[model samples]
Target chain A: MPESSLRGALTEAVLYILLALYTPLHGYGIMQKVDELSHGRVNLGAGTLYGAINTLLDKGWIIPLAGEMDSRRKEYVISETGKEIVAMELIRLQELLDNGRVVTGGTV
Target chain B: MKHIVHKAYWDYEKEEQWLNEMSHKGLALEDYSWCRYVFRDAPAGKYIYRIELLDKTGSHYESQKYLKFLEETGIECVAAYMRWAFLRKEASLGPFDLYSDIDSKINYYSKVINFWNIFAAMELVIGTMNVLIGLVNGGRYGGLGFNFFLGLPLIGLGVALVKLGDPLRAKIKRLQQERAVQE
Candidate 1:
């Protein structure tokens, strides 16, 4: 991956997570939302979500909800950084879809 | 009601499976030391177990914080022995793993290798110290090689750990590179 793409890969888990976190959500909640948002095509595993959450936290892309330290169900909301990353990734994804459309031609 | 099982230093997968199997046998893991597993009687197949590895010489603060984080996610951190943590939760839904994707799983493997490196370094140091001490006391105690021999197990453990984790580390690095280009 290019430096940009590496940073903006927006893997299914990552993209869905960023989308889910647009509204503050807990781990399970995010998992559920990812599944629902992808229309049952993607089922975010707990382990995958857990690791992505940690990575996002490390990058300061997400922050835990207030006083969630001791709570069994902690919530996280996307940060400004997360929003920017999502925006950039969406652009890359848009380009991909556009290029695909061009290569296929407007037959239909 | 209880059983003590001795697990090897790098037997995380087997240890996890064993714990889950024990849970199926109505023995829920309550705690564990380096090689000793403590269990409590429970309904068969009631609990799921997972193991998370930490850096061998992990700090108490970091370990506690991570464990607390796991707890917040509804996983019970039942035991901490050296660099490994034993986590469990109700198995009503199915098995719950702590790392699922290739990248995260690679990271998990890397942590194991890192801990092994730490353990290997510590073993090498301890072995060197033991040999040095044994040499110094050669005439006084007539046990010149005993301390060195005593340290052999540590060195062996270090070697075994390296052997255990090095492959995973290499695989992760290669995968990362290939994945980078593919992406």
Candidate 2:
């Protein structure tokens, strides 16, 4: 993909991870949820997910939760702050979707 | 054998120019970032290289640093605020000792500092509680004096926190300034 396209996708990728973490999810789980929600259009790699998780943690939008430790896998959950941000993002997306529907004669 | 590794945040245009400049100096640009230049074949000793960052208006910010180590094989130096590791097959290079020293010092200092910050914050809370309690009792039975004594230790703790972290803070600031100059 083009660099600009990749940059644009990053914002959505971050939101998808936030949405997936509402019930607490691991890295792989978040990737799967993103693909599912996007109808398989967005397939985030492990490296990208790892980078996103660290960035989200640094920004205080996600927190690691206590977990069973059979493997090195860890679980994360969205914080209260993260929930609020996600809600705002959803509203913004809804507006965009509505605009698109109107432009496309409500077919989409 | 000589090896030169350039490290920096990738900027294709500027990097191409930098490569050209290095080529002119007879140094090969193996790798790089926006803020780092690694040069091999430097004489065995400490040497300082200057870095300059230019703004759109043509104004510049600059910094200088010594080549951390140099041996017959390659040179190991650090610029900007980033750490790097490089190897060249042809050259016998000395290990970059600066990173290890800085890392150990940072580890030691951070541990000491985190402990001190928590301890001082706790002391502040405790001291405030003591003073509040003494005031509520109207300073009866020398309570005011006792609270004042308790508060002194908190003040001391705060002072210690500042003293302990000050040097590290300054070092980080210096490093940041150097990085900005290399941008």
Candidate 3:
């Protein structure tokens, strides 16, 4: 894949994370959901998943939902701000899809 | 194999004591040479090593460096910089102070220009009087010649000062307005 197209995957990672946390999920649970949703095409490493969780928490897009089951495990949920951002992203994706359909004569 | 290495040019006695403490904790001293103490099977991540120098004034310097040779190289790792005191010190020096000094100098220049503007009208009056006195004395006193050399440069300098002041004064006023709005 071209380097320029890598940005799309980054955006997809953020969206996938938000989707996985819709019902409040743990770190490993979210990673599993991402892989399942993408049919095993988007497996996230533990380190990468932890780093993403930290970044999302720092940005106020996610928060700890409940107490950890064990010292090594943590649970997280999406915030209201995160929901709004995801909704905005969905609208953007719809617009892109519409444009692509028009430009490709409804083939996309 | 995991290892922790501490680097220092002095404090050999304290380093030895620390090595012994680590040994008691089950972290075997793998090697010690050239101001570095290496340990095997040591827990990785962040750890602080404090060495106290036996000086009258008790001079102290603290350094913070990440020890991540294993993690970076795909091995297990636990490393951290040693703490100076028991408490984590807040960073209160460096770039922050330099930025504040720059802001103060700009503010000072703005005030100096405002002072000059309030005193500028006096120069025209002084220039007129010197020209009049020179004409009245009929060229022997050369008052106009002296004032011309001195007063003209002062006038030019004053004009340059005002020109320089305009932009800085505007910047200061804009900054003040922004702060007022923020408050």
Candidate 4:
């Protein structure tokens, strides 16, 4: 599995998906988690979610759990590399937040 | 009770909407093959329908797996024809969509556009080749050959298919610009 570059800002969907996979989840579970995490603001359609999951799997950011293939639905969890990407994304997001605060002169 | 309707659809979105409208009229889509749709009686607005062009044909292993995944998500594969699958979810499951974000929508459109463009290009090439062959053979026989007549219609069909992709290409351009600014 190839690792995608971690330099750019992750899309909102990718970030939420990585966050969602902190715990093992199947395709539907991931969708539900993303919806809940965004407070229903982000509703992932089945096709889109499927595409994202496959991309994540290909990028080695997520891996299917062992012994879950007996059933039709397979479970996936975030990989070590995925966690590292998430950490970088957090730092990038924090920088953006800090810059926003400085520019707007609003303290939070 | 089974009700069958023969309809031709050039646009999948329009087909989806028409299927949904049928569902609202108590006709739930049961199966689809070519221009034929089989419907069963159900309550009005009982189901919401969606159509997608799979990366492979319906019988292919990958498409079957994808359909299985969709079924696990409470979306049912109502029918499969060629590379197209018709899916429906219970209307009560809130709103159902196959693409939630702009990026995925653009990706879907790209797939569609690519399919049409390739198909149309093949038609154009074959049609042009047939026409040229017919013309050369006609000059030898002192009249237009049958191939010439056949090729004329094929070329027209190819041109129409290309024209059909125009709006989708425009839609992709607009979405790309939107993504550039928003993302």
Candidate 5:
């Protein structure tokens, strides 16, 4: 895993999605999880969700789980690489918050 | 009761809005083929409608998979024509939007603009070629060949398509600015 490539901050959607996939979730479940986690602040539309899922799969950050042959509801779980990326993101967010408080001389 | 109407719309957003309006009037879109829309009576404001252009034909495997994914999310494809699909969801299912983020919206606009640009370029090229052929084969001052006349409308259509893409480009610009600030 290249730390340099993951240095950039993940978009809100991608970060939320990766967080949501801590447990295996299908498409609709992922959408619901994101919505709930964001407290309804983020709504993942179908098209955007589809595109993001494909991109994440291509990057190997997520792996689709095989279900029944007749089942169209494909589920996914975060890969080990994805967990490392999420950990980095957490550190990055903490830095942002710490920086804000230090500069403002007040708790954020 | 069922009602059928023939209409043409170059803008998918406008078509979507029009379909939503029809739903408000208790006319749910049952099917669509080309410019014809078939509607059936239903409770007013029963469904929300959306339309999108696929990168491939509706029958293509990729497109079908995409549609199937949407179905799992509770959206149904009412009809598909050429590369466009008419989608609908129950109005009570919260807000229905195919693109919820600025980046995705911009991506969609880019796709539409690219399609139109290609169409416009093809029209302009064919039109210019025909005009040149007509002028060279027929006299320049008079007796313009049939190709010259045939090319005029094609050129006009090309220009029209370009003009139509301008607003979408403007939208993309605005969305890009918004993304820069927000994301």
Candidate 6:
């Protein structure tokens, strides 16, 4: 039931975060990646990032790195589920970009 | 130079805005205690202040972990009061918003409602109890007029809390409906 909700649906912040976590990324690193990924267009706030991280973790889309426990600085990686979401999101984005190019006269 | 500003616990948005306004006037928050805020002279437009209310109670470890996380993002914790944490960052680092998305914003609003609803309920409960006891005892304690007057303020405050919850709950519902449609 919950899996159905993950179909083609993710917030912009969550999409960027999943895209950024192709490799292990720390909290701060995720923020930087989002900023870099968006080209400084979408500023991810600390609180919003924290909330998104928690939500993804709850959804089993991301997992905490082992041996980092006992310390507040934890790292995360996109799980298999998270990767699937990323793939879905990428296809969705590709279609959007394709439409833009087609409508905007061959420019994306 | 220093300025002391007093604000209630429920006025966090106003407090954040006021702190930002002060920073714009070349005054950065040095410290604050209770309702009084202490500010010192600093370069104008150099800092951005943010506040987050801790939702969990009696969890020092959780709060510390949150603070540590904020530090990693270049936001430094300057002060903490009860469940509220005050954080600051150099504006030169660019703009930062605490809750950007609707769902996250709803989470924040729910936390606030949890805190204030409990407070307001307690006030109303005590106020009613005092009036009832006073009425039963009659002149043995304070006069009826005295008890009524004393309870009046508490009742008024409880009404204020109820008013506060109405807008917040409506916002939560609105966000939930919008999210439902999108999903």
What would the per-residue lDDT of candidate 1 be over residues A25-79, giving only the tens digit for each residue? 9887887688789886666656567768888999899999989877767899999
DockQ of each: 0.42, 0.01, 0.02, 0.78, 0.89, 0.55
Give candidate 5's whole-model lDDT. 0.92
Q: Per-prediction count of colliding residue pairs? A: 1, 11, 9, 0, 0, 0
B87-174 per-residue lDDT for model 1 (tens digits): 8988875447666456766777776777668878888788778877677777577756678677777677767767777667677888
* Residue B36, candidate 5: C-alpha displacement in angstroms: 0.5
* Interface quality of candidate 6 as DockQ: 0.55
Q: What pairs collide in candidate 4? A: none
Question: What are the runs in model 6 whose C-alpha is more than 4 Å off?
Answer: A1-8, A70-72, A91-108, B1-10, B57-59, B139-146, B165-183
User: Each model's fnat?
Assistant: 0.36, 0.00, 0.00, 0.85, 0.94, 0.73
Give the fraction of true interface contacts kept by model 1: 0.36
- The C-alpha stretches of model 5 lying farther than 4 A from their native spots are A1-6, A68-70, B140-142
Which candidate gets the maximum lDDT versus the true structure? 5
Q: Could you tell me the TM-score of candidate 3? A: 0.36
* CA lDDT of every candidate: 0.77, 0.53, 0.52, 0.91, 0.92, 0.82
Quality of model 1 by C-alpha lDDT? 0.77
Model 4 bad stretches (over 4 Å): A1-6
Worst 10 residues of 6 chain A by lDDT: A1-10
Poorest stretch of ten by lDDT in candidate 1 chain B: B54-63
**Tens digit of lDDT per residue, candidate 6, span A1-108?**
787665655688899889888888999899889889889877777888987898899989999988877666799999999998788888988998889998999854
User: Tens digit of lDDT per residue, candidate 3, span A27-68?
Assistant: 658866987899876655433455467789997899887565
True-structure lDDT of candidate 4: 0.91
User: Global lDDT for candidate 3?
Assistant: 0.52
Candidate ranking under DockQ, highest first, comes to: 5, 4, 6, 1, 3, 2
Better of 1 and 3 by TM-score: 1
Candidate 5, position B119, lDDT:
91
